[model samples]
Target chain A: MFEAYLTLMVFGVVSVGFAVASLIGAWLLRPRVPDPIKATTYECGVEAVGSTEIKTNFRFYVVALLFVIFDVEALFVIPWAVSAKTMDIGFVVGEMMVFLAVLFAGLMYAWKKGALVWD
Target chain B: MSETNRENVKNSGEDSQGSAQAPVPGVAKPSIPAAAHAKPAAAAARPAAKPAAPAEVLPEPRLNNGRGRLLGSARLWPTEVWPNPWARPSFVRGAYWLAGIVAGVLLLGWSVGEISVWANLAYDWAMNLLRLRQVPELWAQGAWSAVKVVVVFHLVALAPLFLVWWERKISAHMQSRLGPMYVGGFHGWAQTIADGIKLMLKEDVSPRAADAWIHLLAPIVAAAPAVLAFAPVYFGSGLTAADIDIGVLYIFAVSGMTVIGIVMAGWGSGNKFSLLGGLRAGAQLVSYELPRTFSVIPVILLVGSLNLTAINDFQSGYWLGFIPRWFIFYPVMGQIAFVIFLIASVAETNRIPFDIPEAESELVAGFHTEYSGMKFSLFFFAEYAYVFLSSALVATFFLGGGNAPLPFLRIWPSWLWFFAKTGLIAFCFLWFRWTFPRFRVDRLMDFNWKFLLPWSFANIAFGAVYLFL
Candidate 1:
């Protein structure tokens, strides 16, 4: 158990080390040509249309809601698939059919409600 | 003078290759410029190789594009170690990939023999348990042996080294180009060694405004859980530090420590970027943890025990002619639990799509933003360690901890089977990390709380009903 603590400590140092190493490596390999114009925060291609502090789009909420829907469904489905491969095909198939039916029902509702339709 | 002359020759030779650097912005392509990036036309267009090669030189740095090399970096660490290796083009990336494959193959091969010994031991233990017979001495020897302690620790640390290499290799191969080939003959297996030395020599820099105590302690706190989380996992079988009654609880509870370390680092750094990264990480880990815990609840309910060693024992034999011992196979609630656990576990560990806290693009390297040298490496190791730790947990529970995937392969003992399965799952974690992009923060959080949490709760209800009936 004590050894484990040391091992974890070593892991902590090593991972950070590699990340830092890669960063250092890139810094050296990359050419440095920073200028005053380039140093400021970017606003797409247009010159700083305003200060770099404008809030991001509110549409981000819509994306979040959509991601939640897909993510939850995947969680429900993945174990069924992994375990299905190991079980009797009949039982696995039957459960999958029911599972898919439920999934489809929800998906259909979402589709009808236009939640699935991303513009 | 020689380097300058070489540079001039290389610069001239690169005139044709100059177009190779055409800016596509947000696109990645292979550097097989001599060939084309996965072009079927180029494959057929191959003329008989020019018998005499042109003496044109090319810059070495351009050769290793999109490797595990940190993006937007200046060689602060690598430059100190292999001044030339980092500076010039070398097949280092390809070498690293090959090395990982070789190491994986070696581990796979070693386990094949070792698992048989492990299986024998597991059979002995399970029989003792089943018959209610106690070899009190044997059980004590198994748990408290000094050799076991050291070996398990090495196993935990070594897994991540291979994992990081494997991640780079997997990513490079997926993106197409050899990964870390130059570091060793087969591939850059030695790349990790070079990397290790480089990191060791790096000056541990603390940000001026950073809280010295917490800043230093944060990395240790973050990394500790990853190592401790492995204590309950069977290495071969019949081999764990302490087979406590609360092993599953141990995994969940210990794994949670990583979030604390990250938060510490973020708060200590005294930077908004770091703080935001820490907050995101904290929220992400906490949200997923409940779902991650519940996802596995169905399985524990079915298994009726949290003893990982015992769990693997249950999975060792064939139910019918083809049944394997693992839980994922032919399960009632186990199947549902397996799926929920796998995804939630991935999110819980803060892997891709769930890695918004450390979102490099927006957060500027996230929680460890101001960290450098070994301190930074500690956080990096913890991230991968968490990946391994959670995968280890996933392997133990719904997938039958360490049991072989196939019933026919049960000639080996359960212990060996367990590690093999755990290692494979760990590989999958690495595989997924390399393949996916970071999830948006709000999307990452909402998915865990809204979707995963509800489904896990539903799974819990269903499992309870199934068990009751």
Candidate 2:
């Protein structure tokens, strides 16, 4: 297990290095023709107005919140999923079914409360 | 000043061109009068602009979109582009191509004998020449790891060059136009190479208001995660970079880091559109990620292992003498899981019909709006790499990694089978781009949370029931 992870570490370094190398190569080759006009933010050729740090829709936050809940649910589910076939089948199935039922109820509650409504 | 004027002319011309292309016979005849009136109005509005007479007289070629009478004007199918056997009803051309491909593969298998024999022998000979038994065991292992790293790095670096050109050609053919016919002789094979050179030679620009450090780091952060995720992906028998026990989870965890890079690019740009695009990407990716993970649970449950190699080994052999025992062959549960995974994968890659994050018309190239030249290309490469990664995952998880579909086809090398499956699925990714319309942002979120998520959950339950019974 550690051996595989050791290889993965090497791969990680190489992947990041490749990106940095390409950027360095581009830096070497690319022409530097700096212009004040080019430096302004792109807003359809017009003078860019207003701050980008303004408030956004709350729907995004709600989705993010829902994602957190489901994602943690996945953490538990994966271990059980991998071991389910080897364990006593009926008991394993029963346990997962009940777990899913509670999650399903949560999903339904979120749905009914209109957290899923996009408009 | 000259550059700004030229841009004005170009934008005006494009707006007029939209009206010019609108009068395509059948769909909306009401637009004909408006289109006809708009031409003179456009010319009158801009006297300095070029003469509209030449563009008006040149008749656009009407497309013949296969069998469907209604679909002829839609331009959804590539009926007119390819040399089809049936001239009139061209919609069934896809079916013929599918049959031809299957037949060609069977013939090749019959003629080539056993490819695995030659491949394995070649591998063994190379290993023997290395004399690894004489060296320290750790050093020999390091050497092997280095080789895998080099190959995967180059593959990640270079695949986008091919995929970008392939996408251009695919999109062009579907729209009944020739894409890059002249560059580098026959069929523009070296078009992307020329493009890379051009992009490298161009000036790199960062907006004055942008966060300098974040803007600089964003592309590197974005590009690296996709490359790192390729470590555990099995290419063939003994072809994996690292045969980790939790290969599937490793890929998911690593690739998820891309969202931060995107968000950084968005926020760092100091542009509202980029920020909006970044927020959408964050919400959309996180929402769809749930379904993508859940869809693969059934596969894990049935196989009883998180290791992709183990999954591949289990999928070998026949179910009823002829049928392969691939996870995709496991009744309704399998089909549902495969489809959910496929859709989620498409969304994850930011492809249409789920590409609102970078909706060009709405967001002006989205999160990368402030990026230019080589920096822009890194983001471009990251997108294509993700496309390749998702297709490979699809091949591994459902289509059985490197396993052959039929008994006789087993003669071919497993690496060949792995790549063949990956290529087919990647083609579907390209096909869907031109075939479907973009989803509205709201509907995109709703579909994931409401439709795909629930079905994926139910499918897991069904998978358990099937396994127990």
Candidate 3:
């Protein structure tokens, strides 16, 4: 029963190993010619002219906030979706509808507050 | 010539600094002071200048259909179609008809026998000849698992090589040109192979300002999940790497990790374009994930299992003796789910028109702007691997996975059917890349939250109604 998960672990290890091995192989075969000019950050041939850590737009934060709220809600609903077929249709559907309606109301609230808008 | 190039670079650098200090039309006022922009090593030699004021309102993208509210129904903006000689040549038309006829005849011929039965017999014979029947079950299982790991790893690694070539050829043909016609002969079938070799031999460069540890790890983060996500996928009737019960959930959770890799690539590079691309990807992938997950609720409800094999089995039979009972065939509800899922999947893979994260004209190569050589190729490998993964899931969730559409078509092995459906859907991904223009960043987000999210939620309600009916 647990062996499938072990297989998954093996797959994970092998996959990461493939990446690391490829890098190692490339390091072995590739030539290293270091130049100060080559090490500079690319700004489409112009000299890069500022710190890379500029202030980001505030709208991305709002989107992230909205995503967390809905993603958690979806996660809660998945188990119900899986088990609903065996349960009473009316009871399950009614229960899920109320849950979804409340979340839908939350989504609407976010919409009205302009949290969903990107500049 | 060298002096002229240096003079050009110096002039452009000064010009860019000058523009940075000037109030550009339509750009929102920068919160940072003008002096902050000149903090770089080369730029510090220049004297500080006063900041510019907001000159003009940035022209709002015409994407919102001119409605005052940003939350209107997303519309397909007009596209400029160019006349292309190669688009529909006489030979191409004949080739399509000829291909269709050949497929029809093949399907007809295929109906006479089943290949899986023969495969099973051959497998048993091989095992008997090797005297492996007496082996312990655990050892056998371990060996089989090892074989599966190798096969899946190779599949993840090699699919991209073929897909990249296929996409290039497809896009080239769509634009009235031949792509890679010379490398390794036969319309450059081995073009990707040659490119792979070239990439491996190329020098890996890291920007002087880059976070060396994170830069090195980014490709692994981006790629490993793509390969691991394949563990739960069902390739055929009994072919799977792990066969986990929560297969659907597992794939979603693992593939979500790829975004982190992308963000790492963006941030670790220490380039503004890479950072912006990463941030955009982070937001865009997160936004679309909502709709993608919600769209699959109907199928999960119907199948009552997150296990992919069970879901595939649920869609195996026909309704009314002819029409297949695949989830996509369900009235109204399935179509909505399928369309939403397809759209969201495209966005998830970061292809055009949703490819704002790496919008080449705007963001350079996006988060990967600083990556080079084998490290760069890893990102490409992960991307094309994702393209294959999403298409496979689309086939599994909407189309009947490993199930023949007609009773007569059941003679072909289920794995063949599975791959055939996956390939057809993969072609659509390539087709979409060449067909549509990139979306504006704002409208791209709006399409998800306002449009796709609402529809996907409404779709679940529709699925409930369809359930008892």
DockQ of each: 0.05, 0.70, 0.55
Residue-level lDDT of model 2, residues A1-119, one tens digit each, is 76687789889889888888888889999989889998988999899888887888899889889999999999899999998878899998999999998999999999999999987
Residue by residue across B1-469, what tens digits does model 3's lDDT show? 1222223336656554554444444544344455755575244333344344333333445654666232232332222244763564545775877699778856754663444455467557755644556876556556556767998888878889989999999999999776887677566889999999999999999999899999999999998898999998988787777889999999999999999999999999999999999999999999999999999999999899999999999999899988999999999889999999999999999999899999999899999999999999889999899999999999999999989999887877677788888989999999999999899999999899999999999999999986687
The sequence of per-residue lDDT tens digits that candidate 1 reaches over residues B1-469 is 1222324334555343443343333334333454453444324223343233233333334324635343224443234345655454444874676699777865665566654466457656765674575557544444434344556667766776777777877778888655776675445777766775566556555554567788777877787667667666665565665556567766767787788888898778766667767767776676676667667655655556666776667666666656665667645566777777788778876678677887777877788877765667767777777777777777777566656666656555556556567778887887777778777665665566457666775665566454334
Task: Give candidate 1's TM-score.
Answer: 0.61
For each candidate, what is chain B's TM-score?
0.71, 0.76, 0.75
Winner on TM-score between 1 and 2 is 2
Task: Sort the candidates on TM-score, descending order.
Answer: 2, 3, 1
Task: Find the candidate with the highest DockQ and give its number.
Answer: 2
- lDDT per residue for candidate 2 within B1-469, as digits (tens), equals 1222324435656464443444333222222343344454344234333322311223343545343343445443333455655554544765676699788886775575455455457657756766745766666667667866888778877778888898999999889776886678656879999998898788889998899999999999998998999898888777777889999899999998898899899988999889999889989988999999999999999888889888888888987778988888889988999999999999999989998989999999899999988888888888999999999989988998888999987877677788789989999999999999999988898899999999999999989977866
lDDT of 3 at A93: 94
Report the candidate with higher TM-score, 2 versus 3: 2
User: Model 3 residue A31 lDDT?
Assistant: 90
Best by lDDT: 3
Give the higher-DockQ candidate: 2 or 3: 2
Q: How large is the interface RMSD of each prediction?
A: 10.6, 1.0, 1.0
Ranking by DockQ: 2, 3, 1
The candidate with the higher DockQ, 1 or 2, is: 2
Per-chain TM-score, chain A, candidate 1: 0.59
